[model samples]
Target chain A: MAPRKQQEIFDATLRLVAEKGYDGLTVEGVAECSGVNKTTIYRWWPSKAALLGAALIEADVLGFDPPDTGSLRGDLVSLVEAVTRLLTERPSGDIAVAALAAAVRHPELDAHRFFADRFAREREIFERAVRRGELKESADPMLIVDMLAGAVWMRAVFRGLRVTDDFADAAVAALLDGI
Target chain B: MAPRKQQEIFDATLRLVAEKGYDGLTVEGVAECSGVNKTTIYRWWPSKAALLGAALIEADVLGFDPPDTGSLRGDLVSLVEAVTRLLTERPSGDIAVAALAAAVRHPELDAHRFFADRFAREREIFERAVRRGELKESADPMLIVDMLAGAVWMRAVFRGLRVTDDFADAAVAALLDGI
Candidate 1:
């Protein structure tokens, strides 16, 4: 299938997942919603889980590595802003939620590892901050990253609020300074 | 059914919801797991959503109201610690994730409202802190609460980390003074 057509299928898959949750999504449903042939979808991917995983990767939903801005705060703010935009500006957040739910339900899936790797990569920003003496030596980079990202995710995804730049700034400030 | 037995049924419901996504869970499964009569469950709850909602309420998963501690940091520390304990000390987090997924997949469900009310109640702690002049008058209580709770939830729930008292203290310090 053409890349554009593949994108359409992914878009449809995410849309359905967003609207129906992961359990409600199916290959037939994706084909129907995307106007793509079911056989074509199967030709590319073997199962629903594989299709969903591929769609997530193709959509770059969980992919991010914000460039360092020479300061921890700047990097975090930029990174969070990008994440906020990614989760809120499109169907990526829904895709992520579906993937998370699916991972929990089906422990055999690789989606858990994929997200864990993404989170580990996210922690590197904080690791850099610690190395630059921008953070306390005792600070757990993983915890700090979790707190910052968690705040954004909770507000935007769970609480259904628009994650403003000001919120991101405050979050980074809280992480760097205390609150 | 006896209240104590009702608790067992609720426990079973949550356990199944946690292990299987909401879509994979069924009332029959819950009945089989709990050894409760299906008719008895049906008598108390009208639908699967209702059953799940009741199970959550009975489990008291998101239920908590941190008392005033004369300072914003103290109050937040207490609040986040309690939330951490709630999500970590038991299977409540999985139940919560299941309910969240169900709510998202089924828009008509009342789980969203239930959690929204819980979040609103959580905001009250910040409201009290602001009233006591421990926090800035300009502070958005909702955002503050979101960040604080988000950090804990993200760590204990999503990342599957044990949220220690020390970490909670640091979170509060960051929120109060800036990290």
Candidate 2:
């Protein structure tokens, strides 16, 4: 499929998910919304889970390139801000929440794989921090990432709280400097 | 209604949510499973969300008493362990996931109320820590609690990771001592 065609499908998938959630999303709906034939969509992605997963990955919805800010604090703040945007922004935020809710009911969706892939990509920031001697080599990268992201999830996703402008900076400072 | 009868209804609600997720849960199924009349259930609860919310609250599914462990680290470790058990244990864990998923689709469920109540109760631990001079008075209690509980949610609920015995201690240490 052409890149533009794939983008259209991905956009439709995200839009549908944002509007009606994952359970309401269907390949037929995607085809109708995207103007793509069902046959072609099935030929490329076998299942609804596959289609949604591909849309998320191809759209770079959950993954972000680790920023090289030359300092651990700067890099972490950037990463946290990226997560804040992902969870607080439209389409992406709604799609992420829908995906997470769907994952609870359908383990076959393999939400863990998406998180794992994103975590792997994001680990580079921590690795560089350790190499730069800014972080201890023994620091658990997964824990750090999880705490930061999970705090955002709690505030922005779980409680539906308005994330303030200082949230990213404050979160990074708390994690790095201790509360 | 008798205490035993209320317990049965709550139990049925939780069990159904565990087996079939929240969307699959219904008052009729709960009534049938619990041997309680649907009319009687509705008279008291009024709606499915109300019934589920009552069950969660009356059963203390999400709320835990703040541990008075004499020190900040001890209290935080205890709090983390409580959250770990809530997310990792049967019935409660499954019910929590189902309710959270349902909350995303149905904002009327007021999942935030449950979390808010839980957080409000848990804040006492931090208050006590400040009184004991173990934590700074300027510490953001919500952020501290959110980070600790959020980390456990990330490990146990999100990633479905096996929480080791040392997880609570390690998480608390990381938060208090900085990563």
True contacts kept of each: 0.47, 0.64
Cα error, candidate 2, residue B13 (Å): 1.2
lDDT for position A61 in model 2? 51
TM-score of 1: 0.74
- Residue-level lDDT of model 1, residues B7-120, one tens digit each, is 888888888877877777788998998888888889998788888877766554445665678777777788777777767765776677667666655655566456576766
DockQ score for model 1: 0.44
| Clashing pairs for predicted structure model 1, backbone only | A176-B179, A177-B178, A177-B179, A178-B174, A178-B178, A178-B179, A179-B174, A179-B175, A179-B177, A179-B178
Computed on C-alpha atoms, the DockQ of candidate 2 is 0.77
Off by over 4 Å in 1: A1-62, A127-133, B1-16, B24-47, B54-62
Candidate 1 per-residue lDDT, tens place, A1-179, comes to 87778888888887787777666789999999889989989999898888877776665444577558888889888877876876676567766766666655554445645546667667777678888988776766666666667777777767666776587787776566553
Task: Note the DockQ of each predicted structure.
Answer: 0.44, 0.77
TM-score for each prediction? 0.74, 0.96
Error of 1 at B85 (Å): 2.3
In candidate 1 the C-alpha lDDT for residue B13 amounts to: 83
Error of 2 at B40 (Å): 1.6
**Clashing residue pairs for model 2:** none
